[model samples]
Target: MITHTTQSVSKANIFLTCTDEKYYRDELIVEKNTVIRMISGEMKIILPDITYVIGAGDTIFFPRNDLAKVWKTGKDGRPYKSVAIYLTPEAMQQYAIKHHIKPIHPSPRTGIKCMAAHPLLDSLFNSLVPYFNLKNELPESLAEAKVDEAISILKLIDQEVFNTISNVEEPGKINLAEFMEKNFMFNMPMDKFGYLTGRSLTTFKRDFKKAFYTSPQKWLTQKRLALAHYQITEKKRRPVDVYLEVGFENLSHFSYAFKKQYGYAPSSI
Candidate 1:
């Protein structure tokens, strides 16, 4: 088994983790200097139209608030090792101002891109591993410099790409239909869904009804239950595994909902 570990480079507000696992993640605003350098293993992201598979040494820059349906897996020794720099919206704004850089804002909105092939990325991560291993607290100024250096390398490869992504935007900036479609599996509250899609509670509900022709709650439940039914009947998955996979918090609730939706127990499927 891979021993899952997370190390925070405090000065930079960056967190590093290496894991051998799988999960369903909610739609999130990328709130950090979001860089994932895949050191080993393989991962896949299922978006609306495409499935992107990333292997070792590939670097992808995920702009803030870009919803991702991420799935990761790794084997015994070669676990999924990744380096991430967390950046708040404030940090990016400040960095841009201090460096005298003007970031272009896309009119409709910008999507995430694969900023691959930064030559210094691997060495840069290697240098930071010692800091993570040591667990030492460092000055915030020094951490700021590290982030600058990261940007410098990224800038060298593609300054346009760097400037575009490094520029942060408000949460809930994504389209409601697209965001919900990409992230319907994770079972979060309706209010959270509203906030993520960048709408007031009333507006979220009103918009959701307009788009789906049903209440958010009813539509979400229908989506989850449909997925569960497909998993059980087509994939030969067990009720025990299918419950959490389809976003039910507990088995009993899942069973109740499953029966209510399908008129039969999940196991009987």
Candidate 2:
């Protein structure tokens, strides 16, 4: 089986991720403001309307609580490798306080933001490489300092990053249909979907029924299957390739569902 692994270079949330698989994909919800620098190979990040492909030497930032689908690919006989630094809320808050920075108005939603080439950002990521060889975790104080330095650099380079850190607002209720349609492929739990869209579990179900005329689970399955069908027949993708991309958990369930929906096996397509 293809595998992906993450090793913490610092106990305070710096990580080194590696994968030898040619293509590995997964969906995630970012729990903290994360900065990732590609060390080798490439990565593709899929959002609702845009797809970003970054190769070695590129860096990208993901805002806290954002949902994203990612594909990592080994290239040129080299395994995919990247370093990620997670900026925790406590660290951000402490930095804001120390710098006397006040919370600002929340900015409009934007997906992942790519940083332009900058020596400081590049140096910060590269400097962490030696930590990977350390047998012991980097001290928490030093790790926090690294995180603070990253926040400081972000503040100087990207105003959006600074605003994201300063804004303390939670997600507000959004249009259920639009949000669900855009994010149905994420394969998240009902409660997570609700929370992301700023609704309670009860409200999400009721609103989903009203908007789609079906339960959330049913709507998601049908939507995922429909997309998978298109990919399989029109795009000439195989069942295994289409399954995870369209939100199904496993090949067996996807095949069963596809056959049920079309009265034929997807492999026959």
Candidate 3:
């Protein structure tokens, strides 16, 4: 589902897409720093400076001024499906000032990329992604509240990523570890991931294990099944509905994955 809303004063647009499917290769012209969150599935972001193949748990912050190409790659070297949130800078700045935090500025380094797998940040991203997608007019107080939460998460990420940059080396070309954590919803296609990175599939898998301490496929499946569990328990809806809602195309596949992850049938829940 894609949702769109605009702020009257700033005329900033917020676009939201929540899907259990893959997206096609495309580019967005955003006038502000756009936060892309992977609610489910995998996404391959091809930026001018770097290409990021992010899984469910991962996110990429594309500053407003940059132009980038994005592709949705699926498992089996195919384009994986994904959902995303897009926000304009003016709206984001308003959210920031209301929360008493400085808005994100262009990094001193051109094309600087920051990646982290903080749980709070993930939650805040998840919450706001939908909020901005749904509302027409945001009251000043509500906007401030959302801004505060977002800022808190951003500050934590800043401290964790920037303060410790020296200790981590170049932080790796791709934040595979963080991607896996944030995108625990499906298995990433090693071949596709490699293709994006200009690496052989074999080499990509090897490097992914070395960097993330896990195989890409295994990590992705675990995340997807876990997300399925969460959605089932939290939604209070029918089991079959949850299945399709979370991106599984068929009941058999969904049931198999659910039992594999939780050792129970969907009906058990």
All candidates' TM-scores?
A: 0.77, 0.92, 0.42
Query: What TM-score does structure 2 among the candidates reach?
Result: 0.92
Candidates sorted by lDDT, descending order?
2, 1, 3
Q: What lDDT score goes with residue 157 in model 1?
A: 77
Number of the predicted model whose TM-score against the real structure is largest: 2
Q: Compared with the true structure, what per-residue lDDT tens digits does model 1 show for residues 1-269? A: 23454323444565566665433223344545477777676667655556688877787777665555566666445766667765556766777888897875644434556666645977776766566665567567877777767776767776665665565665644588877877787666787778888888888998888888998877877888898898889999998877665667788988899899889998776
Error of 1 at 225 (Å): 0.9
Question: lDDT (0-100) at residue 5 of candidate 1?
Answer: 49
Clash totals for all candidate models: 7, 0, 19
Least accurate 10 contiguous residues by lDDT in model 1: 22-31
- Superior by lDDT: candidate 1 or candidate 3: 1
Misplaced by over 4 Å in model 1 are 1-9, 18-29, 40-56, 69-74, 78-80, 107-115, 171-175, 234-245
RMSD of 1: 3.7
Error of 2 at 104 (Å): 1.0
lDDT of 2 by residue, 1-269 (tens): 46655433445689888888767877998877789999998898988778899999999989888989898888888888999998777777788898898766677744689989999998899888888887887888888888889999988988777778665567799998998888899988899999988999999999999998989988899999999999988999888877887898899999998899899999998
The lDDT of model 3 is 0.52
In candidate 1, residue 151 scores what lDDT? Answer: 70
Displacement of the residue 57 alpha carbon in candidate 2, Å: 0.9
Off by over 4 Å in 2: 4-10
